[model samples]
Target: MTLIVGHRGARGEAPENTLASFAKALAAGVTRVELDLHLSADRQLMVIHDPTLKRTTGVRGKVAQHSAEDLQRIDARLGLPGWPEPCPIPTLEQVFGTFPDIEHYQLEVKSGSTAQSRIVLAAILQLVERFGLQNRVVVTSSSRTLLRTARDTAYPLATGLVEEYGLLDPLKSARRYQCRFLILKWTLCRPTLIQQAQAQGLHVSVWTVNEIEQMQRLIDMGVDSIITDYPHLAMRVLA
Candidate 1:
């Protein structure tokens, strides 16, 4: 069966990367979820998409500038006016704590430098180990440095190469990094590429797929998972 991974924990339904968003995804019967990670000023792993807080939190500073405590208290519901509740940014630990039984987690690390990537990866691995979720998590990143760092870890951490554009040789990069998954931008998903990735023992997962027709097409192409903003809609369509 093709798994449905909630994109930023059902981003279409609730504020992205917030606890409320994750809860909404779970409520829609999604077992797999995808969220982004960035290090705060205190070097804590925070669940948020952008390096800057202006998009989600309406703040002027970068995510790395704020402490995890301060980030968690800020309202993340900027574009989603329907959601009256204050959706605070969550720490990765808090997410794991709240949804311990989630089948899988795709944690996308947002790091610009190799040093920062190493620090983030170490923190993530430590948390995964503490939760006994080493088998349940796949550390994903667009940065080759980050993926390489994850691949080199002593822990058997599964890593995924996230390709937003087909700019790089994705298959070669994925193979080079020994990634188990190739997460492609939905537009980059094609039958031959998908098949090639699968033949190389890589699971193909596409991101931000919201339309039912497109979802069905990808499912027909035999994708391992569809990372969608509406898990509920995907569930119904897939069912």
Candidate 2:
């Protein structure tokens, strides 16, 4: 069966990157929960999709500028159904603590800055070791350098997130990094690209795909996994 990865943990149904959203994704039967990580001012790995909290949380400025304590004071603006308590931005440790049974996790390193990248990488590696989850987590990023760093590390699985359509030979990069998968942006995907990736003995997947028709189309094209905002909707479509 094709793997169903919940993008930002049922983002369409709950606040992105919150524990509540992750629980919702698991409840929806999503095998993997995909989330982005940003390093805080104090080098704590915090789970949030955007570089700035302004868009989603009604806050201003970059996530890396604030310490974890400062982030805790900020509300995550949880707008999910039946949510009765206030939700704070969760740390990477908190996420693993809450969801021990999740089969796989796709951790996207969002910051491209040098210090931020190293800190984020170290923090994630620490967590993986702490939780004994080396075999269950995958590190991925659109930046070749960041992906290379993560891949070069001892992380069990690493993947390159390809968003460029004109990039020369993404498969080669994936192979160079020893990545287990190549995550393609939906717009740049084609049957040929999927076939090429598979022929190279690499796993293929796509991201941020919503809508039943699109999901079905990718499934028909033989995508190994699809990252979607609505895991429940994906389940219905797959059914």
Candidate 3:
């Protein structure tokens, strides 16, 4: 059975990556939660997507430039449509604690130096150990170095995200990182790709699939998981 993951915690219905969204996704029956992580200025692993707070938070600044103390006050909801004001930016550990029942976490490690990635991976691993989620997490990234770091750290599940635009052997890349799965953007994926990955003993998961037709196509193709902003709708479609 294909796993249904709530991309950024049911982003379509609630704020992406917020505790609220994660709770909603869990309530809606998603088997997994996909979230992005970045290092705060204080070197804490937090769960905001962009390198800068501009898009989601409406705060104009690099996330790495701000300390966790400063970021906590920045109001994460500045640009998100409806709000009395803004919401607090959540730390990765907080998100992990919120949905202990939904064990699988598709963790995207955003860019940083190799040293930075190691610290972030270590922090995540510590959280997994603390929560007993080692069996439930998959660390992933577009950066091969970051993926390799996670793999070296012995994360039970790791994935390398492949761009749809480029011509590259995803299986070979997964092999290089010793990853258990390969994640691809929607436009860059096809059923054949899923089959190929599976044939190589690697699992396949695709991201940001919003349309029903595309979701149906990938699910029909037997992807191991579908990462989407709307887990409620995806669950219904899968049902």
Reference-based lDDT, each prediction: 0.90, 0.81, 0.80
TM-score of each: 0.97, 0.91, 0.92
Worst 10 residues of 2 by lDDT: 154-163
Q: Arrange candidates by lDDT, highest first: which order? A: 1, 2, 3
lDDT of 2: 0.81
Instruction: Give the 10-residue window scoring lowest on summed lDDT in candidate 3.
Output: 157-166
Candidate 1 residues lying further than 4 Å off, grouped into runs, are: 153-155
lDDT of 3 by residue, 90-158 (tens): 888777776678878888886766788788888887888888887788888888778777667775545
Residue 163, model 3, lDDT: 47
TM-score for candidate 1: 0.97
Candidate 2 structure quality by residue, lDDT tens digits, 2-51: 78999989898888888878988999988698888888899888898788
- Minimal lDDT window, size 10, model 1: 147-156
TM accuracy, model 3: 0.92
Task: Show model 3 residue runs off by greater than 4 Å.
Answer: 151-159
Candidate that beats the other on lDDT, 1 or 2, i.e. the better one: 1
Q: Per-residue lDDT of 1-239 in model 1, one digit per residue for the tens?
A: 89999999989999998988888899999989999998999999999899899989788999889898999898999947778889898999999999976889999986577788778888988999999998899999888888777667643789999999999889999999999999999999889999999999998999989999999999999999999999899999989
Question: Which residue pairs in model 3 clash with each other?
Answer: none
Top TM-score hit? 1
